[model samples]
Target: MNKLFFSAVIGMTLFLGGCMLAPEYDRPEAPVPSELPSGAAYDGSSSSSEVPLVADLKWREFFPDPKLQQVIATALDNNRDLRLAVLNVERARALYGIQRAELFPAVTATGGGSKQRSSADLTESGYPRTTEQYNANLGVASWEIDFFGRIRSLKEQALQEYLATEEARRSAQIALVAEVARVYLTLAADRENLQLAQSTLETQLGSHDLIRLQYDEGVATELDLRRSQTQVDTASRNIAIYTQQVAQDQNALNLLAGSLVPDELLPVDFASVIPPKELSPGLSSETLLNRPDILAAENRLKGSYAYIGAARAAFFPRISLTAAIGTASDELSGLFSSGSDTWSFAPQIGMPIFDSRTWAAYRVSKATREIALAQYEKTIQTAFREVADALAVRGTVDQQIAAQQSIVDSAQTIYDLSNELFTQGVSGYFGVLDAHRTLYAAQQGLTYLQLARRANQVRLYAVLGGGGNLEVAEADFTN
Candidate 1:
């Protein structure tokens, strides 16, 4: 018996040392551009790798408008989508825990009671005899011997999958933050434009009234009165259009907040505040690894690699050891007798010789791992593209903003001069009306330009993965 046991151990060792079935996994390289396009220059702001991701940038620091900041805070706390994201993270954690436990052995207590009766009629001649026997035993059974590393590799794969899920949740959260902030900025800009249109409408109405008075007193021609009225009506119609836009923007903001009429108390008005300061761009590509989605992709790739290792291990011969130790007796009272005690240890091996099924499964796992690697690369490239595009747009926005500001200044000057000429009876009402139209266009452009700058800054943080840890209430969350 001792010699047989030694032979079995040696056989198990030899089989495991032979070879495995799955392929080894290595991280696939990303096929990104060798360098940024010539137009890609980070001139908007400089940043350090330590710059917190957009999510990390507190609402107070980025949006100092007390009212707007309050609104952001409320949305973050109450958004239902955010709540779902938190729950997904918890689920991933629990699933990971379960997978990890599989690496350990399990013990079970087995009990059985049996009774047998034999009848003999002709003993040696296959006769039957009247006899009865009762047997009862209880024992512990277990099986464990991960000689091929299958269980270990499986557990590792699960760990990576769990991490990937967590990253997915974080990525969703990052998008939510950016969306909410973007909507808020949009609302503010639109509100200003709406007010501008309304104010211009009022001024035009006043001018029309003055022109009508002059026409009746024989000081202005009928054409001048007609032109003034046309300008007044056009401006009023435009005001109504902008008013509708402002209302629509507010409604969208309400939806993002996951509420109707979104807490009216949350700050809504900031009196033409300057845009956020330009931030610095980082010095290395490694900075991108900070994005939650990117991290999640990395985790997923790792999990795929582990799965390949496990699948390869599956092709190899697997060995398992089972042990049983318990007591057995003919009577319940003698269940613990010396003769009732017994123990057994057995090892088993299974190897496929010509099984197409195993081969097919292993190949499928390999293909899946390759797919995951490709996807990981794709995600990285997309992230880089987003950052590059945002940076490129930023480089030119400042110059354009400066130039547009000039246009606005010039338009204002032209409108003022045209009004003066009319007051002095030196210009026609057509000139004044045309000048006001130009001014209105310039004003709207300026509002859009300002909003664009803020958006670019926010995008920088989003791509950089700048969020801080959240303190969750563990009492209500189960992992």
Candidate 2:
């Protein structure tokens, strides 16, 4: 009984000893710059009206258009890319679990029945025999020890990889939101332009008929009538193209939303769904680190460092302890009897004796760590640039939109005055057409610029690493 107990104790010790191969992991130091470039933001233009980049702003707060907010919300909820991203997170977590478990011992048991026969002929004494053995038992089990920290290093690498996937998910979500915003903005601009084109088409068509009547009375030249007709045709063509663009853009938005056309249809005037105005942009670049892509890079860097440790540990000798305890008896009743008990224990060591290529692996891991560090630094630089671009453009786009709006207003007034003067025979057809063209161009330009400005605001939020951080409100994750 004492021997049996001693065997059990030794088995446990062996099981525990098998887990000593774990390697410690540490983060590699990389010199990160203190601050992003303090250039004159926004493509480096000399503009005094520049606002510092603020990446934080809720999409709802930025556009204030309830309709667009609804669209964005719907997209966020139903997007297939988002669903896939979530699945990826699960996959990474599962891998982390698998790797993390490697540092611990695993135990399993086996039971079997075997029959053996031995035959000898032409020996000192010919012997023929058949034996049947039945085996059944259960005990602790283990494998290679982790004393050198190999498993620990591997586990750390896996954990970092898992974190990387999470960052990737967030990155995908950010991209999805950005695309939705851009498409929605385009929808609004296109719809507005279409309306303008239709209105101009009607006005020009009316003028075309008037010029025909004047030509019939021999008061207007054939040149004037043909030119008026040309203006009406041009407006009509533009409206057709604009109408097509709206349909195509809607389809594009639907694809991003990952919905069938029959499921949900966005309106042509998506500005009705635009987010709010006067949003708050929380101050600073701390929010940039929270961005999923940046976090992903950080995690990858961690993994690279872990891999270096793993590679270094590979250069050391590997030791393992193993043990098994069970019972074997010819009779079923003796299977659990003390007399039938059997056990085996082993300690093993392995070293790479002749593998000349091992040194290359260490070099590879070291190089990979360097690459990860560089990328980490580069990512920071990119983040700063994005924030600065968004910040610099906010005021610039605002000013441009305002200036363009003024131009549209001025052109409209000039067109109205020119049309009046032409009705009184004080202006030529060419003058009226010129004024109409100016108004058309200005209005279209204003619509486009307005959409661009709004889109920039959306981009700003995204660039600032907005969203997902409850503590930092008003950052632009909606880009």
Candidate 3:
């Protein structure tokens, strides 16, 4: 009987190690165009081999501004959202480790001692009697022998989930970097607007004082004085509005950074904040596959397939083992003595008979797989649209900035001509007032256009999956 049992154990080991019931996995086709769209909106912006792809570039290299880089680094270190993502990755990794340990038997050790007294009626001698016993054992208890790959499938699923969580952490960091840059640029632009408002207020105040002086001397009309007052009031109102916007932008930056931003790192004006380096979308839309969010979605899809494998394996027979080798003795010191050895082996096999829940579980796994497939496709589609939109903006922003600059120049010239004519009595003061209004509007428009141009660069970098190449190890939060 002992020899037969040993042989059966060896045979089961070999057989169980060789079988896997999980279905084969095939990656679904991407649901997007092979190439990006091209036309007037995307002219001259098509990907070229010579152009540098955002994927190869680091965040520091893409954003050359020292202050902005410092701010982004601070955010990476302190942002609560990013910290949570890192923690999730750690959690998933730990779960994967737990699932993997089930592939092998868990051996345990146990020891016990007991003393019991027998009643007088139970003793043959009609007297009370006492007995002592001791035992020690090393054994495996009901360890499931994975004959149909169920444990293996579960392990695979856990591994994929862990990978998916790691990708999510990368995605969070990438988003944080982009958000910091966006808010930084916006703060700079608002500062510039405030300065412009202040300068216009100074100019309008001078014009208002001159018109008041002339009206007091009976040389300027009441209408002219009132018009000057209106210009001054308009400039004053803008100053107040822009001042509030700048404060709000600063608050936003602080929230993203998760701490107070240093004064030295703040942008003084739009022109002072250097433009970020340019990036290319590459010729093929396949680049989107490398994006962190898309990769995360794919990992989830693979995990769902692994779940289906586990579900399928549940239909097969389950084998378990319970075995022990130990020594027992009536005397306390003789527990490990010669001739005291004892052992036990128990193997069990259970076949599924009549449970409706098993079939329902299989159906649920199939439904999960389909859902994952659709989500994977949707992620790819969303990534494609983002890149295309950024490219379209890239194609036309420069022209818009150039046109706005020209308008400022023309308006400045008109304002100068009108002022000269009014002083010489060749034109009315209303022409001068209209020219001032036109020039001020043109200048403000130019500032906004420049801001848009710079913001587009940041957007393109983000959409193309730049800024995720930074290496990050599992964070230690024990402290």
Candidate 4:
């Protein structure tokens, strides 16, 4: 008899295990072009034969700077925002475990003793009497059998949510790497500008002193002396401005790193740093679908679909089972004696007949699933736009940098010629002052352009989701 009952239980478990009500999932079509947009702004080579996909490239290999690699590593290890993202993944995992536990019955062991006094009028002995009882049992409490797959659907939703959280953590890590690299590059450029300003100020001060001596001997006019003094003041003011900018950039870099950054890791000059090698963004835009954010969105959509399955199951009858087997006696010593055994087996069936809430919930779940589908498509579109914008900048930035460099070189030549002409009385000091001003502005502009070019490369790598193998491990928040 026991073997027949055990076989029946096993058969039922197997039958219910295969009953999933959720619709089969298929990935939606990507909402982007078949290939990257082509024009003068995207004139770069797209030869897949020569270049590896950006997503396959490790960040350390892309950056190639020891200090920058170290800074990125530190940010991955300690950045507060990234840490929070990792913690959220853990929270989701635990929630999924909780939902998974619902598939199994909760067994509990219970033991108790009770004593009661009976009134003389009610007692057959016609005197006040006391009754004592002791009991011990093992029982299962309201375990839903999941005949309609309601519990299974909810468990699937939780699993997808956990997966979405994991992808979100990866997205945060990639962004952190890109932001740290960009801020470090900015700091390096500002420091270079500060040094340039100091050098220019020193040269201007020497010119001012020379003009003052010439004026005292009536060889130079007061106008020339005042022009040189003005140049000196301008250079000094620029030095102060660059100094402030450098300090602010350092603070920004430190914030991204989530701690104080050591001076040794800071770049000395923008020119000394080697920018990341240009990546060959493939003609096909399908690779953007592999981005962590895109994957997270799709998982969220799947979770919403699972929720719809669970809501639909709510309209079906729910079956629950409760059972207990134990012994009871008037004395604790006799609780397990022969003839004292007691047992119970109770199964419950509940069908929603008059409940309007179940149908309302089903509608809400379907609406939520539609919203998730829209969001998933939107994520893909945003990613495509970001990659296109970065590639557009990437295609033209090198030429822009080269043109700015030429402007700086020509300005220097003109300034040198004007100074020689002024000393020989062939040109006025006003001509020399104008050339000096133009050269200073050109040099500053060139520095900023170089910084932008380098920063753009980092941005492109990030949008392409290129930092997955960056040697930074996921944070261990168990501590």
Candidate 5:
């Protein structure tokens, strides 16, 4: 009889394990264009024909500056936001484990003792009497048998949620790297601007002194001296502004790094900063599908699909089994003696026949899944836009930089000629002041343009989902 019962139990387990009521999942169609937009914005030459995908480049390789790489590594290690993302992935994993455990029985061991006394009038012997009983048992409490796959569906949902959190953590790490690099580049540019301003101020001061001397000798007017001093003052003001900005930029970089950056790791100036070479953005928009944020969105959509499955399973009968096998006797010593053995088997089946809430939940799950689907599509669209914008900037930034450099060169020539002409008494000091101001403005604009060009490369690297080496396991951060 025991063999027959065991065989039946094994057969039931196999049958129920194969049963699933959840609808099959299908990936939604891509909502964006099949090809990336092309025009002047995307006309840049591809990096190298033999080079791998931009995403395959390691962060260290993409950022060749040893100091910049160190800063990025430090930011990844210390950023609070990225740390929180890692912790969330752990939390989701634990939640998934809890849900997955529901498919199995939970057995417990229990023991207890009781003593009772009966009234003399009610006793068969017409005398007061006390009885003692002791019992011990190993039991399984209301473990659900997932015949309709509700437990499986819930487990699937939990699994997808865990995956989504993992992807979110990856996204955070990528953003952190990009942000650190951009801020570091900004600091470099600001330092260069500060130096430029100071140099211009010194030159203007000399010019101011020369004009004052000429005016004293009756060869220059009061206006020429005043205008030269104004140029000096303007340059000094620029120096002050850039100094403040450089300090602020340092503070911002420290905030992202989660600690004060060491001076050794900071760029000395824009000259020391090396911009990354142009990266090929790959041949198609399909690359955006691999982006971490988009992957996270898709996982969320998958989780919603699992939720709908669980809701649909709610309409089916739920079966639970509670069983105990142990011993009961009048005395503690006799609890395990011959003929003291005891066993119980209770199976329950519940179906929601009158409750309207279950149906409502099913509707809610379906609607939620629809919402997730839309959100997934939106994420893809957003990623596509970012890539397109970065490519557009990349295509024109070189030309922009070249043209700006030309303007600076012309302005420098004009300034030199104006200074010589004034010293020769052939032109007024106004020409010298105008040329100097124009040259200064052009130099500042060139500095900003260089920063922009470098920043665009960083953006493209980030939007392309960063390097393959960045795909780290959760254990990497936790340790």
Candidate 6:
């Protein structure tokens, strides 16, 4: 009879496991355009079929620069922010495991013997006697039977939270890679600027010496000598500024890389870091759904729905079971004897009758779910804006760079002619000085344009979810 009763309880617990109180989840509509924005600022080229999607391109393939690949690899291995993101993911997974374990009963076993003395006056017999008892048992303790699906809903919520953390870790990795690339490019541009300043200083020094000789021979005015001296001083000051800037850029790059970068791996000039190939944004904007941050937001929204279900389940009865079977006897040797067998079966159910707190909790869960939904929609909108901004820059950066280069060429020609005419005594030193200034400014502008072009490529690649294949590897903390 006891066996039959226990079997019936187990069957009921398993049968009601599917009874969940949470409402079904529906994904919120994306509050953005289905198509990517197109305009004069956006590239209209049909490269969607010609090039691989940015999502499909690995970071190494997108960069293709061996030195940069090594530097990024080192950053991925050592960066502390990325390391913390990975740890958060692991912690969420463990929490999910703990929540999942609540769905099953915890069984235990016990065996013991006890002996006690009884006083004659207390026993109603005029004699003192010893009493003995022995017992053994194996059964489940008080384990909640999830008949209302509260435990299942909680477990689902935990699972979604774990998934969200995993996506967050992936998002962190993508940002880290993009930042490292940008810092690396900035360092290269600064080095190029330093070189430009040094070269300009050398040229100005030569011109100053020539003007001084001419002034001494009464061939050039004192004003020409002073102007030449001023130009030399300007170049010397620029050299000092650029030298400091270059050193600061290196420090920034080292911090991003999480270690000192070797000299050979560092960029030598503004053009030393080649821009990555143009990425295809695909025909539609739906690709943004694959981005890690957006995915993480969606996961959180799902978790919120699960939480609502758990809250609703709290209104229903909570059932639990506790049962034990054992043998008891006055003599230790009779513990397993015939007719010494014992059994027990217990079942309990509880429901909140007048608890206002339960209703408040339920209301809070619904509010939280609404908040999550709003956040998910906002994330998608933000992603759309980012991609659009990147495309706008992409369409115009190359043309801007080309125009600046042409200006630099024109300035170089003017400076050469002015210097020659001044030396032949057909023109004043003023023209040469003015031309030199124009050429130097134009060269600096061209370098800046080039850097902007490269930076735009990295941004577009990142916004498009490039490097999807590069999983953030777990850090080994055992050492």
- Candidate 1: deviation at residue 113, Å? 5.3
Q: Write the per-residue lDDT of candidate 6 for residues 368-405, one digit (tens) a residue.
A: 99899999998899999998998888788888888998
Instruction: Looking at model 2, report the run of 10 residues with the lowest lDDT sum.
Output: 470-479
Task: Give all candidate RMSDs, comma-separated.
Answer: 5.2, 5.9, 3.1, 3.5, 3.0, 3.9
**Cα lDDT of all candidates, in order?**
0.70, 0.72, 0.87, 0.86, 0.87, 0.86
Q: How far is candidate 1 from the true structure (C-alpha RMSD, Å)?
A: 5.2
Q: Give the distance in Å from residue 367's predicted Cα in candidate 4 to where it truly belongs.
A: 1.5
TM-score, model 6 to reference:
0.92
Q: Which pairs clash (backbone N, Cα, C closer than 3 Å) in model 4?
A: none
lDDT of 6 at 171: 83
Per-residue alpha-carbon lDDT of candidate 1 for residues 1-479, written as tens digits (9 for 90 to 100): 87988797878667864343335555555566544334336554444565444444653565555555555666677788888887887887787677766555566667766665555644665766443333443333344456776766776677767677767776776666677667777777877877887788889888989899889899889998888888878878877887787788778777776775444543243245435544444555556666777777877777776677777777777666666777767676777767778777666778867788777867887788778778878888998888787877778788889999999999999999999999898988888889988998998898898889888777765665645534333333221
Query: What TM-score do all the candidates reach, one by one?
Result: 0.81, 0.84, 0.95, 0.93, 0.95, 0.92
RMSD of 6: 3.9
Per-residue C-alpha lDDT of model 5 across residues 76-149, encoded as one tens digit per residue: 88899999999999999899889988988999999999999998998999999999999999999999988878
Candidate 6 total steric clashes: 1
Count of backbone clashes for each model?
20, 35, 0, 0, 0, 1
Segments of candidate 1 deviating more than 4 angstroms: 2-30, 33-69, 111-144, 218-230, 259-277, 328-339, 342-346, 467-479
What tens digits encode model 4's per-residue C-alpha lDDT throughout 86-163?
999899989988998898899999999999999999999899999999999999999998887898899889888888
Candidate 6: 10-residue stretch with minimal lDDT: 470-479
